[model samples]
Target: MKLGLKIKTAREEKGLTQNDLVKISGVSRASLQLYEADKGNITLDNLEKIANALDYEVVHFLSSNVVPQSKKTCPPICPSIEKNMSPNMSLNNICEFIENDSPLPPTQSNNSVRIPVYDEVYASAGQGFINDEHITQHIELDKGFLRSYFGLTSFLDLSIITARGDSMLPAVPENCQIIVQKGTPREGQICVTRIDDELYVKRLQKRPKYKLISDNKSYDDIELEGENYEILGIVVGLFQKIP
Candidate 1:
């Protein structure tokens, strides 16, 4: 039987509706529907929660069930990837990759093929900054090239933002490659931020008030607030191509 069918059967046998299982398992209504319908992939953590709530073991859940079915699914793909991906990637459109027998390529096997590039800051390092409304375009580098520098081949969870200005000079040049980690931004760390209507690559500092500081003293620092700005991602790694 399919995983979803098994989950649905287990739930019904225990006299639990989808509501009852969600309340007991803490899984979302949409996800529960997927689980019962065999729609998409479920992380190990979530599967564990459902198993515990349904009074079953992870072994039983996996050993007795099958993967999601292709086609005939509502909306055709699962929406689970939405929260974990950048604009260039579609959370619901990664099913073809899962079904493939081949291994993922270096830097991007399945979801790693595209790395998004945000705007450029020109004032830094004597380059011109360019902004685009449609900035979610991705860059595809050679698979072997990415493997040479990074141990992990997949850059699935990372995003690339541009350093347009020279504010982070000497360390990060203008038009520098700043790979942002997709999660909460930390203070005293380099972050790609959206300040109201504008985007910036700056270092976040909590000096009594929220503010972004520039490493290049020639440029001035700007004060910020949680409401006015959003942290796009954290600067996990920096890259530069050999010219």
Candidate 2:
């Protein structure tokens, strides 16, 4: 059942109207209405308010009809999640327990932080080629490796983009994976940006419009007229793939 219907059902079972719920929960009427309409997601705090008002626990909604990934349906991970677990238990219970108890066991499996690797776009590190934007996959890189190699403090601010062509050359090599961060750059800072639907890793200069520059002398600077460009991310660190 939709979360909204569940909330509405519980509230009606408790003999509470929307006005009564808003008065008891201290949540705004519009927000309560949105929750009932199933328009969007709500925070745990707000969920607690509504759940308490309806005399039901938050997990009741979850465990009642929760399926993170169904075995006969969409579970590449669910089927192998917990083989020895009870059949009566649903995925929702596991999640509910995890939620109530913060900080899951820090397994070595999840110790390495994950960063998204984009296959479609390439920074012009070698020769120039245009590609579409897509996230090919994600890899859990060792936090120690990231810290040692890039002096990075947080994985939350990092992503991996493959470099293709050599417009960046000596500074950025061709066919390398570069770490990117979304941040406002100083003028002349090397950044990963997009123009005309093509992604590029280039030095940026701000004028009335934007100017994308290449480190290699062979490629001329591309003047981006009007608002036809976007700053995707700044190059933080670079790595080579071992064949």
Question: lDDT for every model?
Answer: 0.53, 0.58
lDDT of 2 by residue, 1-243 (tens): 566888888788778899999999988899989988988566556877776676554544433223222222321211211212111111111112122123233332433665554432333442112222334334445565466656777667567555557788878876555778777777888887665445677888887557888888788788887646667667778654222
1-243 in candidate 1: lDDT tens per residue? 556777887788679999999999888999989877778667556777787677554434443212333222313123322211111112122122122343323344432245544432222222212234423334443333345434444555555454445667766665445666566667787776665445566788987888878787887778886456666666665544222
Question: How far does residue 215 in candidate 2 sit from its true spot (Å)?
Answer: 0.7
The TM-score that candidate 1 achieves is 0.41
The residue pairs that clash in candidate 2, if any, are: 125-165, 125-166, 126-165, 126-166, 127-165, 127-166
For model 2, give the 10-residue run with minimal summed lDDT: 85-94
Flag regions of model 2 displaced more than 4 Å: 1-111, 121-133, 207-209
For each candidate, what TM-score against the reference?
Answer: 0.41, 0.47
